[model samples]
Target: MADNQLGEFLRARRGAVSPDTVGVPAHGARRVAGLRREEVAVLAGVNADYYARLEQGRERRPSAQVLDALGHALRLDPDARAHLHRLAGTAPVLPLGRTPDRVSPALRRLLDGFPGSPAYVVNRTLDVLAANTLAEVLHSPFSDLDNLARMTFLDPAGRRFHTRWDRTAQAVVGHLRESSGLDPDSPRLRALVRTLCADSPDFAGLWHTHTVRGKTHDAKHFLHPDVGPLTLTYLALDVRDAPGQQLIVYQAEPSGPDAEALALLAALA
Candidate 1:
């Protein structure tokens, strides 16, 4: 509900990073949430007032160099760093409300080739724009798998689907939060968040945390009812033509337990 997002995210991420983690000495019992404004300025090599202005949303546009420095100072990973650039308006962005609807036929054909791989395409807001058969089976728990965030937060069965449900929820929320910054005025995204906030307190609390992240993954664990358990190596690649879309593919090694599970599911299907 708090639309002062740049400030909120800065504050949240700051709280997450400790002074000791970044080689800043942990002084006496501090009454602050995270690093002081001056500490962040020192770490990022900027004037304290300048950094404070950015956080306060008074200075919305930060040069790429300054954003890079701030990102490094915050110890943000690649996804978070990219998110920071977007928030600072240093990245090429589509007009706020425009979201892509098309997934190329060539890409769908590519997904069809991977019969054993669970592959799908998701938009910036995590809508299931397209998917392979294996991917559909992978996400069968959601009666209508319209959006990933809705399934993750609103669906009760999400707990059983994800092995580490809590972490999965956090990651999903973080990705959604990041997407919000990428396109703040998107009606679809704003409506989804509004619904989730009203329907689920869990979602509301997580949203307030302002954690910005996306699916930058090597592997993910799942507990499927039919497959038992699976650990799939995952990749999320941007669909360059469709700016907001990502091609998410998942794989299990040949002859491995996960592969066996996939085979079994394939046979059953």
Candidate 2:
């Protein structure tokens, strides 16, 4: 990583964004790469000296207001803003490795009970925490993989499985970019990103976009090898008591091919 957490994150996000993104002219004969420190300071409505101190790691603490200003100036999405706070030691430290908190017994039972719908839990970095049998069967291609972001970008079969592969890929990349903001020092996440970037040129290209998006409600189209094409609605529910885990439920439209496909997958499960 870079010298300090804040500096490193700033440097990484800065390089990811172009001057045009922040409304600064891409003038010729620029000295430093990406946005200059003073430019960012000005855009963030802070003194150049203060911004410089923050980026250089000389200043460790920043008020929430200042952080929000900086986040806005950087065009950071929620994930990115949360990441910035974490790097600044504002957010609580998360557990290391894949030792995610166990899914609540209630949630597990819920998944088990809803045999028709595919449901699973994912951590902040898109690590598959747990899945129902049907979820495993429905997302068979991805279940063997640990990280959804990595699978989306690195798996060749992903291209065919995700009908809107390009859009999905971008969304995954954006989500990862947002995550980088929240947990800049997560060694596991950093390693995953490095590995994916090195292995997949598409991942590398998308990472450079510096986009961030949360896993809000979205529609997904799946081309199941056995079930054919199915469209489903994906809902993300923050596990009420489970801080970092999210319950993702996939449901198909009623009385449609998608519904039939779900039934078939459930039977196979």
Candidate 3:
């Protein structure tokens, strides 16, 4: 919406953070909504004037070192840090507007090889590019629904499936926000966001928070109608030479009910 995406991003993130969160005293009434430019400069160990210039879009680009400093000062998580880097133009440039939904032959082979695990490839926006038989069984509901973002926000099934529905929803929205930063003008993402915003008040609120996060490893709890509840860990593998493609593998803990459920799901698949 804003002409300078970076400026908007910075303002959003700044507004999201509280002074107490960063160990800064809320000394007096402030004019600005969030941290003052001077406060951010102090935390980032940079000159106040320079930080102001960057926020104003006068300083278009930032060095990696400066970006890192800003990331640390902002207490940005990995996904947020990546968004900051992309906004600063410090992250590696990918092929212009390339959507990696078409599964490469090699990647398809890799998916086929993983018979034991439920695996799928997702684009930057978490669109399911491809999945193996097991993955298809595991995420059948999502496949039928289409668009992970939409499923997470708009579908009641998602609310039932995820054990930590609120937290999981936040992460999904955060990842989408990060992707939006990397490619602000992406029509598909914009459309998805607009649709979700229009349909779901919960999603709209989280989207306005402007949270960003990378696909870090995390535990997930799923309530499968057939297999019951499953507790699993996820591993996110970034595709080599593919800037935005990610291979997400889900595994159940050894000898647990989750593992048994997975076996059952795989067998049913």
Best-fitting candidate, measured by TM-score?
1
Provide the overall lDDT of each model, using Cα atoms, as 2-decimal numbers: 0.83, 0.79, 0.82
In the range 121-235, model 3's lDDT, one tens digit per residue, is 8887788888899987876665363567877887778888887899899989988887887777777888888888899999988887778877868998888888888888999
Clashing pairs in 1: none
Worst 10 contiguous positions by lDDT, candidate 2: 92-101
All candidates in order of lDDT, best leading = 1, 3, 2
Worst 10 residues of 1 by lDDT: 92-101
Residue 28 local lDDT, model 1: 85
C-alpha RMSD (angstroms) for model 2: 3.6
In what order do the candidates fall by TM-score, top score first?
1, 3, 2
Q: TM per model? A: 0.89, 0.77, 0.86
- Say which prediction, candidate 1 or candidate 2, comes out ahead on TM-score: 1
Highest-lDDT candidate: 1
lDDT of 3: 0.82
Off by over 4 Å in 3: 28-34, 45-53, 56-59, 62-65, 142-145
| Candidate RMSDs in order | 2.3, 3.6, 2.6
Q: What is the lDDT of residue 69 in candidate 2?
A: 90
